[model samples]
Target chain A: MMQIVKPDFEFKKVYETLYPVIFRVAYRVTGDRALAEDLSHEAFIKYYERRNPLPDLKQTKYWLIRVVKNIALNYEKKKLREKKAYDKLQFKYPHFTQSGEAEFIKEETKSFVQKALNKLPYNLRIVLVLKEYAGLNYKEIGSILGIREGNVKIRVFRARERLGKIIDSDAI
Target chain B: MCPDNETLSAYFDNEIPSPWNKRIADHIAECASCQKRLRQFETIKNYLHEDREPSFESSLEQLEIRLAGLKPRTERVSLWKRRVAVPLPAAVIAAICIMILGISLIFSLTRSNLRTMSIRRGPSGTTEVQVAAPIEDLELLLKSLDTYYLKQEIIITLPEDSLFNITGEAMMFREAEFSRKRE
Candidate 1:
């Protein structure tokens, strides 16, 4: 018989508390508001589905946020998969100038640090987001990302340094 | 020497372990170059933290709708799937090892169907083990020792059907007897 483990905490309470934090993390990591919302919901749905293999409710907040990050990573892979299809679509529809001012304007409309953040590779950006937004220590970030604590520290610093450099260039 | 960028960054995060933390703190306090580096990091930290919050009320409403629709996905994991998930190579290797061990054990058992062991005295007056000999031969030797019992030499109290008496071990016991005779 397949056993299902149900935690003591109410699902609604967990949702209400964690939903916003996960959304923010997904947003910061993916740099797309819509994608962030979708990822957050998907993560919640997945965590809900895991009633058969329930995660510890005490660590649910962190688990939810990490799932958000992972969902963003999956989106990156999806983007890679669609790259060829996108190229073909671009070739077939030359009138579709996605490289035009509208896209650039949308980027410029984003916040300065967010624009700088969007420029960073997702791995570096997610580490920074988890540290700053989630208020996670290097060890916590490392545990979530399956990286060494020391590597987490280095990535966070390099991310900050790169972000600073980008902002400086944008200012110039 | 000034710590590398990574170490300084770790120091900035207070992620550096102590002794090093104390040392770096002292160094950053004293060193002009490190102070400038630290100030740059502080500026970046402030900029990252000082963000305007976007209105996520609409997103939250959409999330509520999604959450309302979401049902717990029933995952019926079968025992067959679990059994298959275990690596086949490891299982095959274990089976091979067990088979090899069984075969060797069978061969050793089949080899041990001998009657008795032929124990002969070496040139150094120690008994060496050889092939099987008759139990009657051992009984004859013991009976001779009974006839030649000058004092309490070789006090063997084995039963009539006790030729394979392993308690009277071959080499070490023979060496002890030889030493007693020399004394």
Candidate 2:
């Protein structure tokens, strides 16, 4: 007989084991802990809604990471559009002031490394995040991002180089 | 020629294959510039790793509570996979076929049993009647005719196998007669 529903205990165990990795990947990719939490919740909700559970925890982790990656990409695009619009508005009205809370959050939440990570191009930043935070190998990262392993390696290197430049300039 | 930083970085990550890996190692060991570049990659890796992952204990708790409230959707089984099951389309077609067969059967039986009655005057000036139908249908037809028509001496011809008896002014169908015929 086919299994209809996965038991709740089994699901809970998987959730506890994978939550940290999922949240870390989301945080590193988006550079916002709160957004990361939201993304993590979204990913788990998707997992719970699936009719059939993946065979094992490793596959489940990969599946959740892929969901978070796609969600974060959409968010990144939206953020970019908003930033472009904001920049346009700022150019139009030179006297408009940014919200004090926004400035405060930026100063308080962003570490030097995260600020540098944010400066790298989106493609390079994602590859580097998977490498350093998720601890995935090049082939795995390539599989997750739909790029070749060699491309993943080159992106990781380029991201590191750019990040180093940004950090060094900031330090100076 | 010295390998590029990308190659060195791949080498640092142990991503290069056998002979190239050894070759890059040999080059880095002898070359000061390559060594400095390798160190830069190491420094960058350290810097990325140094940023600690923030604790998400409360978030995890909240997520767990949310998940606890959710029930996983039951897997949908295809009709083909279900045992002793007919697909919805096939069952609908079968029902329509049965209904059509039943309706056509009823129509054909009704047509075969229909009777037309004809009344005419004979050369001798007396009325003559003719009807060809099943006995049960003839009895009903006669009962519905006007009493003026029934007053005349009428004749009804039934099938040889039909069992019918007419006795009184009112032509009534007896259930016992039909039941005996059926038996």
Cα-based lDDT for every prediction: 0.74, 0.80
Q: List DockQ, one per candidate, in order.
A: 0.26, 0.39
How accurately is candidate 2 docked according to DockQ? 0.39
Q: What is the TM-score of chain A in candidate 2?
A: 0.93
Candidate 1 lDDT for residue A76: 87
- Mind giving the per-residue lDDT tens digits that candidate 2 earns over B1-183? 699777778888888999899988888889999989988989999998888877889999989788767775566566667565689999999999999878876765555543444654333436666655444454456565545555555444433443323222222246435545865
The residue ranges of model 1 lying beyond 4 angstroms of the native Cα positions read: A1-9, A52-58, A80-105, B72-183
Superposed by TM-score, candidate 2 places the C-alpha of residue A75 at a distance from the truth, in angstroms, of: 0.6
Pairs in steric clash, model 2: none
